[model samples]
Target: MARPFRRYSAGARWYDVLSGERWVYRAGRVAGIGLMDLQAGDVVLDLGCGTGLNFPLLRRAVGEAGHIVGVDRSADMLAVARARARREGWSNVTFVEADAAELDVDGLRARIGAATGRATADAVLTTYALSVMRDGAAEAWRRAVALVRPGGILAVVDMQPPTGRWRILAPLARLACALGGADIHARPWRLVARDAAPGSVREAAVRGGHIVAAVGRSPGEVAPTARS
Candidate 1:
């Protein structure tokens, strides 16, 4: 199936309003970033970074010395992201148009190296987009992690059906995901958690579990959790 760029194309202009940013999705990014614990001067990679909604929070965390490289397959989305950079005066942000599933990792490294003199990102993040990957979320997650420095942070913020009393909201959640072409069943965050170190991984369920955030480190010092 073709990617869902069409859902975002003409509608890209009103996505913040139409996508339920306030009442639903924003909590995921906020909670996810909190767990990532990003540091200033860090070079962060945002995969499937639709319209750069995460830019402001990321900018605050990275500070003036840091840079953000946002990669998205949708040109319409990137156009809005570029405008956001200009409007917000965020010269530190750069947008690269590419598919997350079939990423050109080395080319990206070279481009980033040329632009910011950093070949690898200090952190890799994806919010609400990995599940849409055609090559598979696990492969996309692996590729994203490979772009990060070994000890760098890896974070994923994606959607799932709400739980408990929030289960009442399941229909609405499913509707929203369906409209956006996301897989409500695709718990892509598990890929990150699977590779994360024992003590370094933290998970959160926000919007009453409609959004799930998993923050962890790339394969490194933290010991792997032993299987039973």
Candidate 2:
């Protein structure tokens, strides 16, 4: 557990290059965000948002009026994320450094309110970050879900062992997951299926099925004017 944090802190600068974003993991995030069906001016909460890799797509989905709150435990990683936002000239994003498992819900809500004029967001997303949370993923997930408005979107993208002919790449997949301190078997996407509004689930498997993306809506009526 501690080892992963150390890696994130020390290796964040090289993460986008070394984390196989182009060849593998990026597909999952792309698919997941697409399934989220975000709208312009929607506020999105990104849990465990390392280095803000999801910022560009989220920004596109939410547009200039929308706000993105990126939460991560690593200050170093958040620094990288901050740099990315600055480099991209994204004024609508905010970075929060806090452990997901022990997140202060009220504090986060207040923070969101301060930024977006609303205490909750229109969506919450976690991509390839939950398995690394290990046993804390559930608690982190609960807190994340709490930060979204009713009928808001939820997206989870995480890793798993490769299936079908892609099984030949199992060793490489394991190595990547191992190096990142992720439990490839974690299947964190199940959280979406378990908690999302009934019949709202949408799923996709990419990167030889080693990456799984799931999107669903929280229960209740989606506020017509839920956007910031």
TM-score of each: 0.93, 0.97
Off by over 4 Å in 1: 221-228
Which TM-score value belongs to model 1?
0.93
The window of 10 residues in a row where model 2 has the poorest summed lDDT is 219-228
The per-prediction tally of clashing pairs is 0, 0
Q: Write down the lDDT that model 1 would get.
A: 0.83
Off by over 4 Å in 2: 223-228
Model 2, position 211, has a per-residue lDDT of 89
Measured by TM-score, the strongest candidate is 2
Writing each residue's lDDT as its tens digit, candidate 2 over 1-228 gives 688778767889899999999888888889999989899999999999999999999999989999999999998899999999999899999889999999999999999999989978899999988999899999999999998888899899999999999999999999999999999899999999999999999999997899899999888776635543
Given candidate 1, what's the lDDT at residue 202? 87
> Each candidate's lDDT (Cα)?
0.83, 0.91
* Candidate 2 local distance difference test against the native: 0.91
Put down candidate 1 lDDT per residue, 148-219, tens digits, no spaces: 876788899999999999999899999998888888888888877788767778899988888999998876
Error of 2 at 85 (Å): 0.8
